[model samples]
Target: MFLEVGGNRSTRRKPTVTRENMQTHQRDREMLIWSNPGVEPTTSLLGSQSSNHLATMQSVMYELMSELNDRSEDLERQMLSLEQRVEQLTAGFNALPAHLSATLSAQHAALVHLLRERDSRDYHRAAGGGGASDAGAVVAVVPLSPASPLTHIPSLQLLRYKLPLLRKRPPQCQL
Candidate 1:
């Protein structure tokens, strides 16, 4: 028999298979088998091992997917909880201004009532069981100081202007 040599296409004579070369080849094949005992050099055995590895890899991928899904669900629940809390806070914030206005108005009315009661008491004391002329002639005026709480109120801006006039008048009774 003849074998083609490279791209040259030259026909080379077949090598003579000596007994010694055949023995060497057999020894090399035996050594390869001996290196890994009980491991058959068969396509079927290799295919089965490859299939087992593929199954194990698929199972691992499924487990990872399940864990990812569970984590995503937990995060979604937490996000919904946070959104609910934010809505509650927003509602409270929206109602705050009206509640504050009501509180300020109540305080203003209480202050006005107190002032009127004080003025009434002062007028009665000046009258001293006398006629209406004594009550009209004697005027009891209270001086508003800069440090008073009324100065801090935005709605009581007119009171700051009226304070000077009250200060100019002399008090009938000093309390």
Candidate 2:
């Protein structure tokens, strides 16, 4: 009789099966079909699915990179605005008269002297001088004054310790 393997296709007709041999013959045929080594059918479909997944992942990564770049630009703009505000404040303060600047400087010097004296008195009782009293007692508050000695400028020290940004600004004053 015709055999239906898996689909509508049929093989050549054979003798009718006897009841005793039917089970044994079917088993033998099944074993022969299973033992034959052949390519799996699903490989092409699985490979295509993997490629699609990789493309989707790459698209997501590109979108995140673009977002990060946008945020970086925003931060740069904010930093520039802050710098401009600080420069405006400095200029306004510098425009004060020389007499006023000198008065402010002298007041700051007096405050520094008082603070240093107070600190020394407090620490003297605890540490008992220990021979380093002279060094520790000198509270150096270098006032950011426009009139105080040019040699006393703290920004001069910062020039050596600086990155490239400060060096690029036009020097309005020589000192």
Candidate 3:
């Protein structure tokens, strides 16, 4: 009796069984068993390939993580530098009004001194005297005039009219 094994080729085989034919049939059976979908491949055959793929993926992930960490650190440093710069600018801005006020005070003192000297010269001339020979040595007192523009405009009002021009506008951000 002939037993059909593989395909149509097995149907044309002689009914007699020989040793070489038995070995060939065993090898074909072994191939079929190994190729079956239900059978799992041997771990020894797949181990090196899977490990190599996993190692490559791990190295790539490590490199990406390192790059991300470096960028984050760089951004942090930049933010810190920006904050320090802002602090310096804020200090300068806070001191500006005091500096300007001191300068205006000095100018006002000089102007008052000049006006007093002019008033003294006028008084001496009206009293039928020539210009003072030692004008630098003279300390003259002058009465305040109610009609002066300076008396009408206070320093605080001047600052109010001018200070808004120094204010910074908000920055517009684009998407």
The C-alpha lDDT values of all candidates are 0.60, 0.58, 0.59
Output the worst ten-in-a-row residue range by lDDT, candidate 3: 166-175
Window of ten residues with lowest summed lDDT in model 2: 166-175
lDDT of 3 by residue, 1-175 (tens): 4655677776675676878889998897678667865554455347678899999999999999999999999999999999999999999997776666565555544644653455566658779665443332332223333333333435434433433542331122110
Per-residue alpha-carbon lDDT of candidate 1 for residues 39-157, written as tens digits (9 for 90 to 100): 65564468799999999999999999999999999999999999999999999987776666565555545544454555566668887755333222332333333334433554355
Q: C-alpha displacement of 92 in model 3, angstroms?
A: 1.2
lDDT per residue (tens digit) for residues 37-141 in model 2? 352325545667878998998999999999999999999999999999999988877676565667655654564454445456656776875543432234355
TM-scores of all predicted structures? 0.52, 0.32, 0.50
Over 4 Å off in model 1, which ranges?
1-46, 128-155, 159-175
**RMSD, each candidate, Å?**
11.9, 20.7, 13.9
lDDT of 1 at 25: 80
Give the candidate number with the greatest TM-score: 1
**What's model 1's lDDT at 66?**
100
lDDT-wise, the better of 1 and 3 is 1
- TM-score of structure candidate 2: 0.32
Candidate 3 RMSD computed on C-alpha atoms after optimal superposition onto the true structure: 13.9
